[model samples]
Target: MAELEPEARDRIMDVFMARYNALHATDYDRFEDGPKGTDHDYLCVSSSGKAPLKVQHTRAWADPETEWRVPKDVERLIVHALQRRLDERKICDRHVSIRVDSFPPKRREKLALLEKIWMAVEFGLNRDWSNPSLQRLMRYERNDWTQFYQPISPYVAELEILERVPPVQAPALVGWSATGEEGDGVQDAVFRTVEALKKKEEHYRGTSADLVLVIDFEVMPYFQDELERIRAALAARSIDFREVWLVSQWLPVSADQVWPAPNVQSADAP
Candidate 1:
């Protein structure tokens, strides 16, 4: 590879580093400007299809009773917000697109994913980008090349990789599924419960419980580990977590204060 000039090398490194950050930052909300102190942001989707990508931010959260629409212009905003965020880190390339059906439940899941990419971009946009730092981080730079054209060596690529770290969200209460003799029915119920919790959690992401414990006939063995992983991931981005619990068959001994819901809403309810 031809050696890159000093200026060219600096510019390329800046682009690489900024892009790395935007993809992993804890802040995931596309509408929100700048990074939130906590790791991870809640993504809201309106199932009614009332909210378009271009839907106004205020309208989306207008009232609990009113259904919000995603506006048509959301794709453009996603790209714009992402690019602007990426630019802050000195990344010049704004070219990007969403793959098909990334968010399956969403009417425009692809756009949502695109918007997510922008949100990821926002996480890494505001950081220091300097050539000397790059050289130290990269460990390999073309010293023989002329000022106009200096190339990055192939071996040096590995060094650059070392400096890159995955963005993390800490102690997240992801989704849940029940397993046992009542696997199907229990799982279905848990899914609905988690979805409800997710909606409520949107109002508060970082300030609430980061752990969700469901006392059930059978709980997944990896549940706690998974939650910890989420916490580590969010910690990288400074996001917090809130925990939720679903109790089935038997409640936790310590959860004497917690109570189960009455069976008023049946599964077949229209």
Candidate 2:
């Protein structure tokens, strides 16, 4: 693949930063100590630098003008940014730290709706339904029609901390929940694998070296929005890696230089 132009890289970074804001939305007003006790922004710090790279000291929901286009859910937005970074093959070693907390009441409600819609849609398409009518009801739930509500959350937000990992150890890391025909196959698989990896990583203190792999599966485009939300969800989690790589048939190209990605991991056994 060809290199990403500086403009493209900037756009990718913008997306990465905004996505992080969306994912880290939490309830800050509810904190008794106010903003100090609450993590109102997506906090990213590069510890290696003499001074940290500070993007802004503002919340994803607030701008000088009106609020952001996206309502801002911490998990959904951050993961979306991270996923974009991975898709572009931009994995850095900049000792980056991300913290998403402090959401408004409405933002919390929006997140719940997004998650519920996503799960409902995923179930309708991926799981078996003896009665198609019930499945349809779940897909077209009542709350879906409410104002300021959407089936999927907008994949945008604010940028707090930005750090680019070094050029070395840029191996890609693409995680998918592997659930589909066999009860939400790819999504389930990827979710299970990540959960297991998380447990194992914590268990071994991040010392496992097994080449991650996935079984066969397919998903309909009917749930593209849901998939995007799911991707955002996974990205929000602060998963660590020394030299991680993400490989997928959907986006086989690591052409997005802003992501700092290495070669793709093979689906077949290495």
Give the winner by TM-score: 2
Candidate 1 lDDT tens digits, 14-90: 33223222432322122221134433222222344322111101101211221111222333434355445445555
TM-score of each: 0.16, 0.19
Per candidate, the number of residue pairs that clash is: 42, 52
- Residue 215 of model 2, lDDT score: 12
After superposition on all CA atoms, what RMSD does each candidate show versus the true structure?
A: 24.2, 24.2
lDDT comparing candidate 1 with the true structure: 0.28
TM-score of 2: 0.19
What are the lDDT scores of the predictions, listed in order? 0.28, 0.30
